[model samples]
Target: SPFPVHINRQQVVHISGECCHCLRLNNLGIFRIHCHGQRGLIEAKIFNLSVGNHYDIGQKISFQLLESYEQLRQFPLEIFRTSLTILLTAQLRLVQERIRDLIVEEKSGCAIVSFQLFEIAAQLPKNEQVINILRNLIDKQAINLIDPNRRILHAICGSLVIGPKGESIDVKLFSQANGDYIGEFTPKKIGQYRIDVTCANIPIQDSPFFTEVYDPLQVHIGPLPKNILIGIENTLEINLDNAGNVPLEVIITSPSGINVPIKIDDILTMKKVHFTPTETGIHYLNVKFGSDIVPGTPIQMMVNNAHIISAYGDGIHHAVHEKEATFMIETKDMQGDLQVDIEGANSVIKTTIDRINNSLLKVTYIPVEVGFINISIKWNEKDIMNSPFTAIVTNPGNIY
Candidate 1:
């Protein structure tokens, strides 16, 4: 007698028997079996099963079959059962151990993320297919990409080309000859960017990678006056912006090749450098921020000659007709002989100049008129302080 049993197509079923012969009939989708020298019957029913496209990894597919036999002489019937299970999995594996984060400058052309891929089995699909799988996984948005500050959750994988300010950027994917994958994109703004990688819809180890972009430092140098006088203290102001919280180094060189001391006040915002030039020529000021020189640096200043300090006269304000008047002159850093001149209303008053000291000059003159008296003092043709001094000449009797 024959017993009916059902089994799933392509599922293996075990039939246990000693000295039993079994034959597969491909045309009828059944197995023919015979027991040695014994009257036996076999019946098999098979059902076709289709696999769904949404299958997950490690999912199990199983089927079972039951068989029963009745003895020819009315012996007790025997039953047997068999089952099989198949697990679904892919051959893709992440070969690279760790992925590092990236750092880029603002307006940088591109950012690249590199990784390696290898297969778990030797009989897996070709490398092209594996690459396609990776591409498809990325295209399907299986990986999460975002900018936390912007609060944006990327919807498309390739479309994750945005800067810190939500600006459009260009992105690209590369296939390397050494079995490595590279993802690249250009950043228009500056900030932190995060990228996550996944394989077979599962997050890869060290999945999220961080990238930081920053803007370069900007600097500006002095508003120095075109003409700077010698022997006078002058202030050089340097306006530094975007110093980026770093200490600034500044240097000033005089025309005599002497380094001038500089003082930086309000270092963070406005910086000031005060220097007093001794010699007269073009002076150079060099300013540095870290290892780079600031823009418009090495400023040139035209230093002119020295000027007078003070000048006075004795008895010149109310000079007598026949009395002698003495005039004194003081200059800053003047060392040469001084030339003195005195002129009356109609005649030139004769005067004698005496170098009392290195920076001092004395002149003695006799007033011959009752009008205004003009005294001129010079050192190397340059006027001393108040060189053209005026003195009133009144009557000797009316003088106080």
Candidate 2:
């Protein structure tokens, strides 16, 4: 019989057999079976543990019996205990050794897997990395941005004095191929510094950027007469010395704070602006110089649209100073008549005598081609006070 098969979890059963010849001989088999989940496995061995029989401690045994004996009744009780002890000892040793091996294998597997996954191949940081560095630069305040190409670097924070490992190292902020940023921070002092800049959100890592401070050059509109007498045109001369490479803007402001119209002559290198007073009062002159100008490059003389008298040379560096004559005209045409014209402070002809070139004077008739032009003048924003001068004109003489 198969031992009734009623045990669960773990069970041990013994099967004994005998032949009719030796009634006292008994053969025994021991089985240790276990069922876990829905699967079961069993370890079985047969042994003759009779006190008088030789039994090797480590030997394989079988369940087949050659003979049976009547004294085998005692065989069940003695052999049963002996087989149980041997099976328990062997199972315990095998399970303990296997559990330890599994633990060791699991730990070793994790270490090996990590080593394979995180190896650093020789490579550099990319554009994205560079962008991050720029962002950090702004946050740390290493530089300030006035415009796209203009920036100022902080003296102390911007330098890498000591190296990262306490050894002197070279530090540079550069752009990479992929646009990533890699920093070579040579830390002289063990401290943190910030880089700040003023610009739009877009980054300018690989672009052309320069760090230099520009100062504006000075210009003078020259001091004018404190009191501008009415009926006199006040003449003001403007002067500028190129303190910087960039050209500066020179503007003259009226007493009303409006920009006064003036004549600009761009001479050799200095730009000269001549202003005639329209009203009498203390006037303000405002001049602004651009910092982009090259140092010591002066804008000699610049001309405005107002009045043009005599412009000597091409308005290049060291051009001849210009001169304009403002005077009243008395025209005597071929018809022999005298006419007077008042020239005001306007940039154009203030007032021209109509048909004066054809007018008749005294008892003589003046032709349109013959006349005497008269001239007179007053200084500053004043009226024409002097008598007019004569401009002579002669008629055409036929040759052939």
Candidate 3:
């Protein structure tokens, strides 16, 4: 007869055969077969004591007739149990019906298997040799829906760490109330750190990630000029000497709530931010470092339009014909091109300008053709205060 069936759980069965008979389960060293003979009938069971699910599998149990105790020659059970040259077949055939017993799949980031299967494999009697041979082709299994509460084994887990080379930092890893896993690490120094994750003595997917540490406190911003002029290039310098490799953000808002475009240049070791204010009113400046506001940020700056500049000297009023006319211009901290225009002169008017200092320039022009020559001076494309001075020119007719 084929092997008996066990479903959901394990069952023990009694076996009796004709006199001088023997039973053997071939190639199943793991399956412990218990045999005992009484008078004319022999009794034996081939398999371990176990409990499983939906396992109505019937395997062929080969039987062979042997000379009774007379053939055993006393102590039959001992001698026969040791020298029972039993060679059984290792073939799995559906003794009767074709049934779908188990379904193997992966779900929820985990491999799903019958919970009862592990129970059977880990049973007592310690049949390691046989179980290993037939582990993949196990006896029976049940196709059950996934149930989180019936977790009999470990749910795939891993560990994560972030630190510098050969130096580990403190990391806090926890699960939130919403069941989301979160990780945090505090770096002690400003350097590159490696993130490692492992599971079951093996590296998990995407094991290593890199990160850098930065200190926002080391970022410093210099003082901005409280007063600035419109249409003039004003610059602010920022010092990030001790700060790590991080980014700095700056925003300049005009009086009309418009964001002014600013140019940032790296000058030696400092950052120079240059912006030209167009509106004459109160403007705001914003600065930040890695989502943290730097000290003295969002400062207030008053903007004033360029006013008329004053000019004086002998070159603008009276001059002798064919003589050089000279004048001095005070820039008053103003910036732009220095221009000079001479009118009422038919001949080309030659002009010369020499920069004496940061805010002073010397202007010279010679008038060959004279007719009340009008002179005009403009700074930054705009005329200065009291410009277009008229100069009297008279030819020195036949000077001695």
Measured by lDDT, the strongest candidate is 3
Better of 1 and 3 by TM-score: 3
Per-residue error (Å), model 3, residue 346: 26
lDDT value for model 2: 0.28
**Candidate 2 structure quality by residue, lDDT tens digits, 289-343:** 5423323433222222122111111110111112122222322221122333422
Cα RMSD (angstroms) for every candidate in the order listed: 29.1, 39.5, 25.7
Count backbone overlaps in model 3: 6
Candidate 1 lDDT tens digits, 1-400: 4988888554221222110111111111111222222221211211111111121211111111111111111221121010000000221343221111122111112222222222334534533464555455556655333232322232224422211112222434343354333444443333333343333222333333343332224555555743455776667676654333334677778767898766667755677777777878777877766445666777777776666346776654557675787866776554454677778888798887787877676778788888888877765555566667788787758658
What TM-score fits each model? 0.29, 0.23, 0.39
Error of 1 at 34 (Å): 70
What's the lDDT of the predicted structure labeled candidate 3?
0.49
lDDT by residue (tens digit), candidate 3, 141-212: 211111223322222222111111134444544433542334444445543444443332223334344444
Q: Is candidate 2 or candidate 3 better by lDDT?
A: 3
Off by over 4 Å in 1: 1-218, 225-232, 242-244, 308-400
Best by TM-score: 3
- The parts of candidate 3 lying over 4 Å away from their true place are 1-167, 175-181, 202-207, 223-227, 266-269, 313-400
